[model samples]
Every structure is written in C-alpha cells, then in structure tokens.
Target: GFQFQMGDGGAFEMMGGGPRRKKPKFPKGVPKDIAKSMNWLKGTEWNWNSWRNVKFDKDGTFDAPTHDCQGGFCRWSASPEGKVYILWGDAGLHELQVQGAMPKEQDQAKMQGLRMKGRRTSDGERCQATFQRVFDFEAAELERDLYGILGLPDDAEEADIKKVYRKLSIKYHPDKNP
Candidate 1:
C-alpha cells in the first residue's frame, strides 16, 4: 500500500490520503489585478447554466437554495454571462460546464458529468475575484449609487429618477403605493 505524504506547501496535487477529499476551486478569467485586490473567484468564470443556480448574501457567503441549505448539484448563474456559482460535491473546478461554441440545443447531449464544482469565493476578499455588479449594491458613492446601480445619468432630473424608480419599484417592491 502506498502511504500519502504532504510534500512542499501542498500545491493541490491529488496524491493525498484517506479517500482524497476534492480540492476547492480557483476562479478563472478574473483580471489578476482585481483578483489580487478582492480575493474572490469570478462568478462569470464557471459554467453553472445547466447546473441549478445558487444564491449568495451581500457578504459573499453561500446561502441556502431558494435559501435552502442542503447542497447538491446546484450552481449559481447561467453560462459565462451570469455570476455566482455553488457546486455540489468535491468536483474539480475545471470539470464544471462552461459556455463553449456549441449550440444551445445540443448542450445536454454533451454532458459526461465529468466536472468540477468550484466553491464560490466571497464577494470581498484579498487576492480574490469579485463580481462588480453585486458589489455595486453596497457602493456608497452618490454617482455610482444613482447612475451605476439605478441605471440613470448623474445629470438626470429628480423627477426622472423618482418616476423610473416608482414604476420599477412597483413590480419588485413590497409596497402597494399604487
């Protein structure tokens, strides 16, 4: 029998001991600058479209599905376009699905299920990649809060913001001001 040994900083070689716990995932496509600064894995880097989506709190931690806690084959978003990812089991992150040039209709047929479910890195961590879109919510800058998140120009009139906010709010908001 070959006994496993921990050699030289343990840089993630799969020759360990006892059943080989799957390795955690590293994010991809995130700019090195941003990654180094935030310490998060780019949500857009993984393929979670076919995999069920996962959600996270503003703090970058994984939340329960529909807020549920029983983790499984669930992922965060769809394709490379969406953000956030939570995979079930100890999958090699690289094995996870991705947005390739293949046609949408034929995707399921290509499933070998040989994938990696890279666990999500929190939204704010040093040497990590973050989804800027989510961070925008917590942003405090007036210009960013108003224009960047709200989708308005800084020069837009108050009336415009209110009107748009009111209309958009009705659909998503909890109030019945209408």
Candidate 2:
C-alpha cells in the first residue's frame, strides 16, 4: 500500500520521511525543462465538464472515457512554450494553445492557484464546458521579450532558463527582501 501526500506548492510528496526526498529521475535525453513540465502535469486531474476529466501520468499515459471505446488509455505532450498536444483514442489529434507562462519547476503552486481561481463558480452554478475556451480567448494578451528579461540567448535550454529565473526571483521577489 502507498499513500500520497500533497506537499508544499501542490506537488505530491511520496511515501518517504526524510530531510530531503529524492526526486524521480527522468528518462535519458529528456530535457530538464520538459521533464519538469511533465512532472507538473503527472497526477494532476483535469476536467472538461463532468464527463471528460482525465489524469495524466508518467510516460504520457492517461485513461479517459470515450464514446467509441467506453474507456481507454491516451497520450499527451507539451510544447516548449506550453501548448498542450493530446492524442485521444477517439478524437485523433488535438492541440491546445495555452496562454501564460508554461508550467516549470517550483511554479506548480502558483499555476495551480491560478487554475483554481479561474474555475471558481457560485454555488448551484454548473461548470461551463467552454471554460477553457472562453478563458483563453478573454485573457489579456501580453507581448514581452522573455529572452531579454532572462538575459539568455534565443536557443537557451530549459534548465538554463530555470536557473536564471530562480536567481532572479530570489533577488527580486518582494517577500525575499522583506
């Protein structure tokens, strides 16, 4: 038997008690940034209305209820800039354009908070099937030079971007100084 605990920032802490639990190793050749994105996605439940919810796991595996198959496994992937690509057994290929910073290391809690905030509805209100669709369309668009802010080259790896972001956050986050 195994127990899952929600750790700080909404990530699950595995069944271990220690000063520092070991992080799972990603498969070889997977970029750290991509691995981090995948880890954030894994084990997190997603819902599109009440019937189309799914939970992705390691190695891009997921189980979803579909009309044709009753229920079957599926696969998913994310782009560098955070677009989601899904290959459901019945629906063929679907691409989702996610607006905002893509999920990355140490940002799981923040991202989760945003999602929760967006999905809040008054009691007795049914969740809209077009929630994500409407939200993506209505989100305030922004144009920023991300590479310029990070002082990185256009082709910088995800790991490098993360390192710089952590350093900058430590230096500039309001709570850090106060």
lDDT of 1 by residue, 25-103 (tens): 3357431122111222322122233434433332233333342234333233224332224432333221222222322
Top TM-score model: 2
* lDDT score of residue 68 within candidate 2: 34
For model 2, the run of ten residues with the poorest summed lDDT: 132-141
Clashes of each: 16, 0
Q: What is the lDDT of residue 165 in candidate 1?
A: 88
- Stretches of candidate 2 exceeding 4 Å from the true structure: 1-38, 49-51, 67-72, 106-108, 113-178
lDDT of 2 by residue, 103-165 (tens): 543233455532321221222322322111111211111223468668999899999999999
Name the Cα RMSD for model 1: 15.3
Q: State how far residue 56 of model 1 sits from its true place (Å).
A: 2.0
Candidate 2's TM-score: 0.39
